[model samples]
Target chain A: MFAGAAAALLVALVLALARAVLGPTVFDRVQAANTVGTLAMLLLAVIGFLTGRPDFLDLALVYGLLNVLGTFAVLKFFRYGDLGDPGEDEEHHT
Target chain B: MNTVVDILSWGFLLAGGAFCAIGALGLVRMPDFYTRMHAAGVTDTLGAGLMLFGMMLQAGLSLVTVKLIMIGLLIFFTSPSATHALARAARARGLQPLLATGKGPSKRS
Candidate 1:
């Protein structure tokens, strides 16, 4: 069952990769990349079970947190041209 | 008793995998980015939740189950925030969503 789930996740990862490659805009690419990160995290967990190493769940948890952070950081950079920029609301402080 | 748990775990895992695949298909087939975001949301939330739930059943009251729950909670809280940020950024940058009126975003591929 773990093997089956892993295979299906691999298929999903490939499809998401195709979107990332074929994306017409940067936003599309970012979105696809986010999806890919998510699929990869799930795959990691499933493969851990398939290989009898439950320790991989810790890795999966870390990956999930990173995925969310990375997505937000990239989007902020794309929007404001800088990650540290506080946007218009805090421009006065700078 | 053990057999029933195993059966239920397998079923959940299978259903989760199927949902993940279908969502990825939608990601590929959707006409635009916003629609694709909708599809990806399915994979992020439903796919991850169900699969983790299945794994929890298999773990059967262990620290592994605790870690799984932590992961689920992280995804549950952050996925929507990321999606919302992405959509807001895309819109602010003038990437209009495709509307039903047949006039899609003016930006071309």
Candidate 2:
């Protein structure tokens, strides 16, 4: 059963990859990348269960954290053109 | 009782996987970026949650279950925030959503 779930997740991952490749805009690609990260985390968990290595759950947890962080980072970068920009709140800093 | 648990776990995993695939298909098929984000949200929330729930059932009161819950919580909280940020960024950049205004897809500006 776990194997079946893992296979399905693999299929989903491929479809998401296609979107990332064919995405017309940068935001589309970013969204696709975020979805890919999520699917990969789920795949890690399912595969870990199938292979009898419960330790993989820990890895999944870490992947999930990194996935969201990566999404936010990318969005921030696109919005501000730099990761460290303080947005419109800070003025007269010339 | 054990058989019942097994069956439930299998069902959950199966449903979760199917939902994930369907959501991905929507991501590919949806026309607008905002609509695509709507589709992606399905996989992020429902697909991930159901799969983790199934895994927890299989783990049966172990550390594995706790870890699964943590991952679920992480996705649950962060997915919306990320999606919100994405939408805001797109809007700030003047990417208008495809709206069904009038006789065809029209921009809301």
Candidate 3:
């Protein structure tokens, strides 16, 4: 039964992937990416339970954090169109 | 005893799965970026919350349950913030929304 549920989620993931490939606009792709992240978190939880390890839950949590931070970073870059700010960025590096 | 919990979980997971599918379809079918964000929000909050709630039912007050709750909370909070920032960025760039007085999303991508 649980396997069946997880299988359904996999189908959803496929649909999201389709969006990522053909979304036309960058924001559409970003939306797809976010959805993918959420699904991945759920999948990790399910896998953790199924295998009885439960350790994978920790990984899922980390993945979730990365997912949000990654999205925000991408959006910031998209908005600014530059990953660095010249001397100010160089100062941080030094 | 177990039957009630089983039904609850099944209902939740199934409903959440359906919402996720619909959200993805909207991601493809919507006309533009902003509409896509609206659709995406549905999946992030409602779909994810339902699935996590179902999992919690099965989890029964454990560390896993706490983690699941955290996941749901994170999505709920961050998804809206992401959407707001995206929309604000778009608007600031002078991408006028094609709404009939804010009725629906822009009709063109």
**Highest lDDT against the true fold, candidate:** 2
DockQ of each: 0.79, 0.83, 0.53
Instruction: Rank candidates by lDDT, best first.
Output: 2, 1, 3
Q: List where candidate 3 sits over 4 angstroms from the true fold.
A: A84-94, B101-109
The C-alpha TM-scores of every prediction are: 0.92, 0.92, 0.85
Residue B79, model 3: Cα distance from true site in angstroms? 1.2
**lDDT of all predictions, in order shown?**
0.89, 0.90, 0.78
Q: In candidate 2 chain A, where is summed lDDT lowest over 10 consecutive residues?
A: A85-94
lDDT: which is higher, 2 or 3?
2
Is candidate 2 or 3 superior in DockQ? Answer: 2
Model 2: per-residue lDDT, tens digit, B28-81? 988889999999988998888888899889999988888888889889888899
Show model 1 residue runs off by greater than 4 Å.
Answer: A88-94, B102-109
Give the DockQ (C-alpha) for candidate 1: 0.79
* Residue pairs with clashing backbones, model 2: none
Q: What TM-scores result for chain A when each predicted structure is judged separately against the true chain A? A: 0.90, 0.90, 0.85
